[model samples]
Target chain A: MLGAATTPAEARAAFRGGAVRPTAGIAAGYVQCNLLSLPAADAFDFLLFAQRNPKPCPIIEVLEAGQLESEVMPGGDIRRDVPAYRVFRDGELVDEVADVSEVWRDDLVSFLIGCSFTFESALLDAGVPVAHIDQGRNVPMYRTNVPTRPAGRFSGPLVVSMRPMPAAQVADAVRITSRYPSVHGAPVHVGDPAAIGIEDISRPDFGEAVEIAEGEIPVFWGCGVTPQAAVMASKPEFAVSHAPGHMLITDLKDSDFQVP
Target chain B: MLGAATTPAEARAAFRGGAVRPTAGIAAGYVQCNLLSLPAADAFDFLLFAQRNPKPCPIIEVLEAGQLESEVMPGGDIRRDVPAYRVFRDGELVDEVADVSEVWRDDLVSFLIGCSFTFESALLDAGVPVAHIDQGRNVPMYRTNVPTRPAGRFSGPLVVSMRPMPAAQVADAVRITSRYPSVHGAPVHVGDPAAIGIEDISRPDFGEAVEIAEGEIPVFWGCGVTPQAAVMASKPEFAVSHAPGHMLITDLKDSDFQVP
Candidate 1:
């Protein structure tokens, strides 16, 4: 029960006591969020960036500057809750650690963004096969030709995660995912890598590439990596984010966002 | 023909030349927005307020500080586009004018918020008769006991607009309006207004009260005026907003938000 917690609070508690690993399969039924903390000076700009591009940056919750506990996840300390965190300075990754309390600042404003894992779980629940999850690999992510609406100094190309499914089930997959709008809802693109300016399917900009079988086509959903890409491009003097694949498990269940 | 323009641009052009009045039933096919312009210093707080209370503050577009034109309504001027604007200083109305060019500042950020007109249009299109519109009166708005999630200096009671429909048509109205998430997607309450702490059924804090016919239920949806209430309560030093019922007609159509 140590690594396999059933609730988000338990999972966060476990991670708080030095559980430094990815959080993919932990707290299975809860909502997992992508974390982004920026200095108060830049919070408005980044928030505007998220507001302009909601598909890739669907905000779940925003903790006011210096606020530790989220209303959604009460008594949870964001600094010590996540399994791993990556610290950046001048747009470069300077440190990756299990606890970010050492570097946390009073003026840092945190944003919890919706992740694809919730929708992927929904897809799996609906019997739609997720190729990357099936292969025990990371979902394929690519940089697209689509430019995000710039806000202040933050601007970047849209990043998307691709999952291949049989052409017959694409409609069902879309239907299932569309219900969870807060979690990067619905596929942005369905059939072509070249259409969104991707040169190769095998090599992804982030995450591991997976196989697309015969009779299957690549479907893309707006990835949460987009804001990170903006942080890299815009070079916001200081920032904090969850490490790749490591996420903050929130107390809310996916059912909360299931519109129907 | 001059006052009966069918396009958003033409309607805005007419308003620019001192055609000051309410914008209901104008350019019926397009969307109308509630305008809220604040200085750059208060932009973040207001934006955060809108984000936290999205049901009542669905944003259509945000024009940055000093930015004149919106990408959604190119060739349009923010100062001269709307039929009427109410200028407020320290939360008290100072003037109501058609053009705000003289009072406009270089650091003012304007937010175009989704108005109920779009969804009301959709509801009427779906054959769900709206009571207020039937009587040619304003939708009754109430100050609910439900407190909105506070953001910075922005916090106030959730204001809701009521529409009475036959019990048989309530479902259709909800189903129809739910598609337009950008313009208050679904009803927040149906039936007894006392559930949300409304002491009087006939009295409303804002807008005109209309009759709830026999066999009809009083349905309430989040209203756009919630932000104005916050402005009144929080008392920002300076703000500009659309006069009650006077909205900015945008180029986008209601169908654009009519998600299937």
Candidate 2:
């Protein structure tokens, strides 16, 4: 749910005003993040988990107990800021809701994780064509053999998103994305999927698969959805995440995260 | 105490044989790290602290409790690999020794942290002159107003190392170092040092001060010594660290850590 507005506050207001939809392609220059809210008791462990596995869970901001608004993203409310949210209880999908205000707890901690959407914009600006966006579909994702470091009870195989591009552009794509470490920066796997235990590239465990043209190499990046998978596997008492494709928009400009 | 050895294994062997000297310029191209060995009781918390504050404590490898050698760095023994060791009891420096084998306990966990020396070499190779290296002295460091994200009992002010370079080379220096996140990627602050709470650039809180020319700007990088400072402040019952400049050399090459 978005308008011609360029500010994060405006986007949040639109979402709060019954505009329930995915957040893709909204507020082009700003950052869109993945949301993860968990109990305070589990906060430290989860934060450590994210830290140990930064490529999968690059934290942008962490909200303290009972704090719904982020100090980093001022005036942004977590309760109703995201367009859509998925609630999980004991690791099972309980319901998809527009707002989580009813079940909000004072002891809950919220984490804003970097999404690939920021770097995807960078790739596009650098003349690197993204296949999924061109085909009007979700980027292909797969469960790889790569194991994530276990922190407390959180541990699972890494999840990666795949994009196919020419060998020459791969280097340029890497250079552009590496500047934004807050997002999943650089490719995790560059060539064959079989090397990482992916049997067929066409059939993905998650998201729609895109065609890999001749002379194109399949490149993979650590996915933002990895923490959600970890939470599901850990089976925490309660967890909430932005629904797939739906994201929380923040006031931070993409350029603010650039290294130089 | 170094001899005509050209390999990391040889360097470790020399150190193990009672070498108590600075590791600067030795074992060129191999990765050298700052060591932090603490009791198992504080292992998780210390790791969390490092994860929460990666800019200062970029973890290269973590050895489990009671483990000395690392799979990541083969044939290297932690107990006597470093040129020198400093023992701290209740936050007080009790002793500095060439080897810690006698005091080594089964409950101790080792953390290998990225040192700024790695990136400094990268900067110099990129033709960005390092002021401290040119003068044959330690890089100046200062306690800053920037606060680190506290985890468990570990927290303190950020300590940054300074290098004076012309304004034109700042961008290139940032780009080159940013690719090596394992080595305190990029400059944390540039231009005004007073903004970060540095009272005097001439007299540093740690290390030797170098002359900052009129056209040059003082660039600050997150230092590896930050964890030692935090550990000292936290007053842990038992802790160990490599003597200043007496780093632990690993088999990893500097190019191995580049993001692309």
TM-score of chain B of each: 0.96, 0.96
- Clashes within 3 Å, all models in order: 0, 0
Lowest lDDT block of 10, candidate 1 chain B: B1-10
DockQ of each: 0.53, 0.24
- Model 1 misplaced stretches (Cα beyond 4 Å): A2-5, B2-5
Error of 1 at B177 (Å): 1.7
Kindly list the per-residue Cα lDDT of model 1 for residues A122-230, writing each as its tens digit.
Answer: 8998899999989999888999999999999899999999999899999998999888888998899999899999999999999998988999989999999998889
TM-score of chain B of 2: 0.96
- Summarize candidate 2's per-residue lDDT along A1-260 as a digit string, tens digits: 36535577788888877688777788888888999999976776687688778888988877766777865567767988898999999989899999999988888888899999989888998899999999999889998888888866688889999999998899988888777878988778899999998999999888899989999999999998898889878999999999988899988887877764
